[model samples]
Target: MISGSIVAIVTPMHADGSIDWEALSRLIDWHVEQGSDGIVAVGTTGESATLAMDEHKMFIKACVDQAAGRMTVIAGTGANSTSEAIELTEVAREVNADACLLVTPYYNKPTQEGLYQHFMAIADAVDIPQVLYNVPGRTACDMQNATTVRLAEHPNIVAIKDATGDVARGRELIEAVGDKLAVLSGDDATAMELMLAGGKGDISVTANVAPAAMKAMCDAAIAGDRAAAEAANAPLLMLHERLFVEANPIPVKWALAEMGMMENGIRLPMTPLSEGAQPQVREALRHAGLLK
Candidate 1:
């Protein structure tokens, strides 16, 4: 059970578009001290698509080295191609990541059988624990419940980061595969509702900014303390909504840069926070008490 708050951490960068390994190590230390139970490196929140292959492998290795056993490091090693995913999973194993998060194939809408086969091949390729990530909104190929249940039968496919944000469906998933696998929320906006409905924890975007609050909220909810859970999350509602005003790392990178945690640089095809959204992102940081 990968319970409690797990940050889908961002990949910090230098102004020249180089990986900022020093800041990244410091961020890892900060998250551990803030009570984040685990870290997911190079995930959607980490701006995976923008990272080159060499940088990706090095980032995962850096995270594993910096955490040094204080936190579980989940490497986001999924790819649109089956063999590519296997390649990355091999890297994950090489670095001794606690587990690997395999997102549903992106930009290629494979059939249910295709999804099953894709995951099956990766599972066969690696011996590490695996968590499936289903975010159709970004990947564009949603993993329906039936496909997910089928994949859950695999011994290596141990958990899921459900980001569909549909509570009824999430509850249905729990009812279908609850006892067999862990169900962690991936959507920060609906994290509370989904978790109360049986999710073990969250692979949270909000955790990047408010790690202690997110961890406390998860711990309280997992303990069935609804009041404490709600209280812990109240101050973060605005951040949950605003950090996403732009697509992902854009706003998150801005927030982190504003806090002096990372450089404001990002790879091509994704730019810095849109001018209009900068003030909102800044305020979200201030509202979350991350700003000076």
Candidate 2:
């Protein structure tokens, strides 16, 4: 029952785009101090796509070691190839991560049956608790509520991160699988609504910059305090929308750098936040009280 704001933390990098271990340790410590319930290391926001296998393993292990049991560490152990995903999950387990966040297979776009089998195989291979990540916008594969319910039966498949941004559908999924699996929102914009509708928490991008605010909103929402949640979330609406003004991690990484939390370095294929978009992100950060 790992609930509340679980930050999909960006992997801090140097200007040359190499992993910045010192910055990463600082970021991890900051999250623990800021009251972040958990951290998702090397996930989509962490540039898992750009990181090499060795780098991915190293980052996850580093996150687990740095956190040192102060908070939950959910390693991103997903790949389009089932065997590759299994291998990553094995590494997460090896390093004693609290759980593994496995996104649906991308590009190849497997059938629902294939998706079910793919997730089940990994769950079977690794005894560690696994959280399903379904972000069709990025993965090109949508794990429907039915298919997700099917996977929820697996003991190791403990939860799902629904990024569809459909609150109605999210509610339906909550009603159907809420008893069996922990339904978490991966979409920041609609996270409050989903949480009020019985979601456990959010695997949040917004938490990257405003972890304490996100955690307060989640805590309030999970407690069924809509008024309290809304009060906490009102300031974050702009951030939820603007952080995606460019592709993820680009804007979020930039926002972090702006707050002096990290360097303004993003990898190839994911450039730095464009000059034109910089003001928009900065405004959102200011609105959230992250910047002066």
Screening candidate 1 with a backbone cut-off below 3 angstroms (N, C-alpha, C), the clashing residue pairs are none
Q: Would you give me the overall lDDT of model 2?
A: 0.95
Distance from true position, residue 35, model 2, in Å? 0.3
Clashes of each: 0, 0
Candidate 1 Cα RMSD after full superposition onto the native fold (Å): 1.0
lDDT of candidate 2 over 1-292, digit per residue (tens): 8689999999999999999999999999999999999999999999999999999999999999999999999999999999999999999999999999999999999999999999999999999999999999998999999999999999999999999999999999999986789999999999999999999999999999999999999999999999999999999999999999999989999999999998988899999989999999999999999999
Point to the candidate with the largest lDDT: 2
Per-candidate TM equals 0.98, 0.99
Clashing pairs in 2: none
lDDT of 1 at 257: 85
Worst 10 residues of 2 by lDDT: 176-185
